[model samples]
Target chain A: MMHQKMTAITALEHSVEIKAVSKTFGSFHAVNNVSLPIRTGEFVTLLGPSGCGKTTLLNMVAGFIDPSAGAIHIGGVDVTDVPVHLRDTGMVFQSYALFPHMNVFDNVAFGLRQRKFSKSEVTHKVMQTIEMMKLSGMEGRRISQLSGGQQQRVALARAIAIQPKVLLLDEPLSALDKSLRAQMQVELIEMHRNTGLTTIFVTHDQGEALSLSDRIVVMNRGQIQQVAEPIDLYRNPANGFVASFIGEINALPAAIYQASDREISLAIGNIRMTAPRRAEWQFGQGEMVQAFVRPEHIRIATSADAGCNVVTGEVLTHIYQGSHTITRLRVDGLGPIEMRLPGGDVVGRVPVGMPTQIAFDLSQVILLADKSS
Target chain B: MTRQRPFFVQFLVPAVLVAVIFAAAMFNVLKYSFLEFVPGSLNVGGFTLENFTRINRPIYYWVLLDTFILSFATAFFALLLSYPISFALVRAERNWVRSVLVVLAITPLFTGEIVRTYSWMLVLGSDGVVNTALKSLGIIDRSVPIMYTRVGVVIALVQFAMPVMIILLATAISQINRDCEKAAANLGATPNTVFWWVTIPLTLPGILSGFVVVFAWTMSAFSTPQLIGGGKVLMISNVVYLQGFSSFNLPFAAVLSLVALVAALGSLALMKLLTARLEQNMATS
Candidate 1:
């Protein structure tokens, strides 16, 4: 059965293809010339801040907004000129736009009915979808009677009941509270696994993008910055934007002291450190570069860690989270630097206004050319 | 204890005064309805049930039925014509287009009823604009009798009621969550289906209220039917005028006025019941 399904999916060229798509409103370019191809049954996320064109690209794919240029294909068929209803793609709006006038069953059955399904078939599909979404007994309830999370499920069920070729989610979890949002994120992962539909999720929350997406397309200023899996994106960001955006990291200025094929030496203020040279680093010796280090990679220095890769700074503040603590320090040339330590041990050990020695794990450090200089 | 609002007495004084005057006038009308009508005199005699019993005649029943039918037709046609205008007024993409629609839809309300009715007279009269245009277009060999007809009266009343209808419907169309329509379309519903299933249902409350309001407003319409009807299409108000002023039977006229008021109230109550049920079904708070 799995092999048959796979072959059926491979019969189509791709689940969704956007080629050189652009959308402009007056003189403002909402989405610039962009192209992306989503494989069958893969979950991709378009992650960006507001006005980054992620939503615009999703709208174009849904056929809600026509692109100013280029073509769009769903299931290997060019649907650029097709109307929204004929495109056969499902979209879950950010507002969870379940029909207020319809009961839960009707809302879920809407697409099936529109597709001219038999009454028994529509009922069977709707009930199955509602069960999958865990909304069994609430089928007769009005939309206003449901809580925010339940309404969200109904919206999802309504979109997926038709079993469209591709599913579009426009920040589906943004309206929920933090705990509920996290819970829904897990549910979303399970839903994706169960359905295995080609899905494109849009969100501005980087943590959500990192956790839920199989591959994330990070966007900035109406352009794609990078496309990679979450782990690779966090570990090896293509530029300063991705490095700063994906997670908390300190960007410190450094000068390349010496360069070789295997290792490179860098100077930060009066301190010196050496890092294993990456193939992507083509900078020469004596050139300016920016070094990025994650907070978890920095730790308080012990007596055994004496000479290289250690810097002294005054402790400014400690933010004690339940599992870990984040400590802020002020170095001489690096400005403010944050370090995350496990447990509350660092909070009691390091007092404010006292000098502390901290070491950087140079193996995980990220180096990029200092473009501002 | 609740805090006392300042100037409470001052705020209550004008409302109290108006209510007192209105109550006194209605009481006089009620008293006059039971009194005997003296021909060729403004004075009335002692109390009698004759004025109320006189309404049992078939001619009076026909007049009441005519009034109800004309008001219903006016409200129906007004709702039909105003919905598109209201939708356009609320949904026009350009600022200038909305502004133009608002001005055109509402400006007719500022003109005097007499003035507007006269304007319609010129349009509907024999050898007037309609006849002249139809003649020039060779659609008809002779002029149609639009003037002094029920059709002419309803046409004038519909135009008169459209401004209010447009305002109510426009408010309803604007309050809809646009995402609902988009969601319907996204879920494989055609544009036409989306409109019928989603947009129309969402605006049902507004449609009901607009229809009822126009119905009640047209039920007591006096000048338009009087001028345009030219004594041919005798609505309740025209009959009341004929009895009170021409025949000098104030008691029967008061009875007719009371009947018109009751009919209007009844229709409004029916509208309230329907819209309340609709609101409950949608649960749109």
Candidate 2:
């Protein structure tokens, strides 16, 4: 299965290399000195919380807005100053920005017509793309006649029909409901596999970023926090932002008491615990730090007995999400910790106000010194 | 949803009132179109189709042709002048400009049609200020005789018809989405092509309606044509008036008035039919 999926990948020729990009709206910088290379035929998502300059970077690549200072090259040719139309990139908007006046056939043919394709050529290509998108007979239908999902597919087909060097999708599926969004994600992945077109997708939804991209560039506040493969970024985030964004992570302030190749002991007030040190940075005798561990990695202990993985805590609340549970507990020194548990884990009722301890693998935790966060 | 009043009685009140008034007025015209003069009697004694058939006379044909030609000329000029002006009004973003545009577009519509036409008469009349200025510049010896000409009639009609076209075209241009223009630009079309293909087509339906409205309005207009024609240029309305009041041939006048109404209605129907076909072609293509 992995081989087939890999076979679907093309390592396509380098499509866009946005270097040292910075876009400022007046004195406020929307995208500040962001540099990321877009691999050809790879689905790269710029993921972040809102206002993180992901969309601004995508716009610079699409040439919708000029960058303050940057060099952008598509297909190895510098397109830093190219107009949107001349850049020859297709952009699919979140709103599905399909032309209301034109029917499906003519809407898809619009770009082809601009390039002066022959009448027969435009018709054949448009029909073929419509069929490829599984909208075979929708050519005669008006744009408003189609559902949201169908309109998205038509937009996709229209974008790809021109055979643009790259596709820039600005949160294309964000407007869709969850189940439909998931379905379109699969379809989009399949389309990418079939076409080998370089695509840069932007979104604030973390799950979408994780599931769709070959690599995710997690951003925070107009700057890229980390760029890594989804699995790697989830398993090992470069800093606090990626750790908290990709999944449920517990961030606790700790001081590195001692460090070695195998283990690093950290202290939070009177509580001290030792976890494996994966970071390359060396700490002296005492340095304030941030320790991150995934919520799922923590195991709940039924009783507190001064065991190896234990903490005396007062339970504040319990939330029942289907198939799982979240317990909000106030540990001795830690303010409050949320523990996620799957169904069928506990034998007795786990109600609020009862004390519980959470245990976790030492190696799964990471330490960072980005105090600004 | 049915009303309690008797069907024809409910319909007939206003219907009969209008029909009776129109019929009585045209009856006088019928008497005029057919009355034969007793050589010296100036006596409207016998009935004949002389004046109705006399429309075949060369003078009447030329006058008829000139009336249509002038109406069309005015319609074309109004369309040309209003389209861009309306575009600016629709696209203006500033609040003051928008309010000012609304006032400017509405001012002409608010004025009485004859008041506006007579205002043009003051400007166009020979030995009026226009010819007086020309006489001073030595551009012509006598006050240049342009007043009471077809040119003066056309000028008056165009000014009278302009406000309708402005409001209609503004409404049309306002209906277009700016995003469509951006989409065209993104597709590599230059700004001009976007206007020609996308913007113009969207506004065509509006232009068609406005054209038909102005066409019917000009065809039925009597005062401007009468006051400006000055007895020299005889339009259909003038002839109709002469038949009803001067000649008093009621039946012939009735036929001619009906012909005028039919002509206006026919053009309206033609406008709708052509546009519907255009819409059908747009959909299929």
Candidate 3:
């Protein structure tokens, strides 16, 4: 009860609160009951694949969509009943939505004009925002007259010119090219630091989420898989879905031989290893499990290395990625596995159709209950 | 540029043939406008400027002015009526609702113009549906004068122009990025404000084009104004009809036709100039 109270108080102190929000269209649920609290001036990201309800959740907060159940609060006030215009939130759409009918100046001046700000005040604020967005001297340019990047900057400038209670960005970088997306990502980080406004960003790209967010909410199939910092999410995912979704991981089948409070013994084909038991898993002896290991966690073992979790496999292909090489191996009974080796050591060491021995770093192994069983 | 010629170019041959026929008809009208009208004969007399001079009279000028006014009024009212229907047609969520609106807006177009005009005659007559309904409701003791007045002609003409306006405006509304309205609302603009600021401006190009199309179409209107006006409201086409078939003054009728054509083209050119500037200001292009 005390913890629940503490959580409620924390949510009140935050800038935006979504409590048990759900949205359904006919028979399909687009967003399930999801609750999250975003603190003031924090840059939070909703990371998920397509149709994972990240955008739906963001729209509910923006008031473009209403949750079928529960309430949303902004600044400790319930705003679930409020329309979009009264919510006082600013949003940057993926398409930029920069008001093609208006020039850069008018687009940025729109929010202030709606608030009935004095002429001088409106002009002053618009000019300041344009300058901050590096859109100075292009005030008269039409939306079609500007480049993609400039248009994106105008959208950002317009949304921020209102100085809204919270800012919502919906895949704002997806439309840009690779280099431009990276540049804008840096600019977005800088903007977040400069303004310190509470921001909720939605994106399907894990790299973008990792690089730009203070914390990320990972979602799948309309449910939140895990909510953690970027490093923590990468290092310690809560489930098999998140482990594979966040990065490249290799899943291998194994059977539990013995179980203890702190350790468990697992058996693969002709190899047995004991690993520390994951605190979250309760597995019985002889239970089938799947072990997930990242490419970098497995390495080539020396000939003298014995009595370790090692296996022999033939190299299928070696992909050279400038700094490192990804070696694909076909194990005798464990199927295909991959390992990342430093470029210098991998150039000629692992030839295709040759037998190679690799050892798993037992500490980094993540095990989950085998769904097939 | 180096690929084989497009197969669709073959279709332009028939279109070119149609254009030639239209041009020949226009030349015939132009030649007849220059000829003199022969009394009590079907044949024309020698070339003269008399028919052109005859149009300088105040009666013809008044008819021309009335045509312009009626066309403008019809277009204005049609825009006012069609805008809501067009918006609803494009934004309605249910398929059945959209289908019903589409049928209601476009079914008039498939009906012949004379048939539609006659239906309007029934609705606007002294003992018509509107008058009877209004009288039964005790809103008026006597039937309001609708037929044989400029108001009746304009009302019928407005209904005639609505299908085209709805189509043009619907295309514009559908092409609009809905995000613009959402963005406006998110920036603290009310729904009314968003409508005026974002929605109206973005669809300005379509609205102007639809208005101009309806205006030009109503400029040449003949049947509705002729039947509804009942000789009280005189449009240019009605005057041409009277001169050509009733008075057998084909030359004068040809002259009036030429004048009406020039007037319609001139107004279209003027509107093009105005809308070019508007499209530029709105950045719709």
State which candidate has the highest lDDT: 1
Backbone-clash count (model 3): 0
In terms of lDDT, model 2 sits at 0.79
- Model 2 is docked with a DockQ of 0.22
Q: After superposition, how far is residue A68 of candidate 3 from its true place, in Å?
A: 1.1
What DockQ class does candidate 1 belong to? medium
The lDDT values for all models are 0.93, 0.79, 0.91
- The true-versus-predicted C-alpha distance at residue B199 of model 1, in Å, is 1.5
TM-score of chain A of 3: 0.91
For model 1, the stretches where C-alpha displacement exceeds 4 angstroms are A1-5, B7-9
In model 2, which regions exceed 4 Å deviation?
Answer: A1-13, A302-306, A312-319, A330-333, A344-348, A360-362, A370-373, B1-76, B90-115, B122-164, B203-285
Q: What is the interface RMSD of each candidate, in Å?
A: 1.5, 4.6, 1.9
DockQ of candidate 3, scored on C-alphas against the true complex (2 decimals): 0.61
Candidate numbers sorted by lDDT from highest down: 1, 3, 2
Order the numbered candidates by TM-score, best leading: 1, 3, 2
The TM-score, computed over Cα atoms with residue i paired to residue i, of candidate 3 is: 0.93
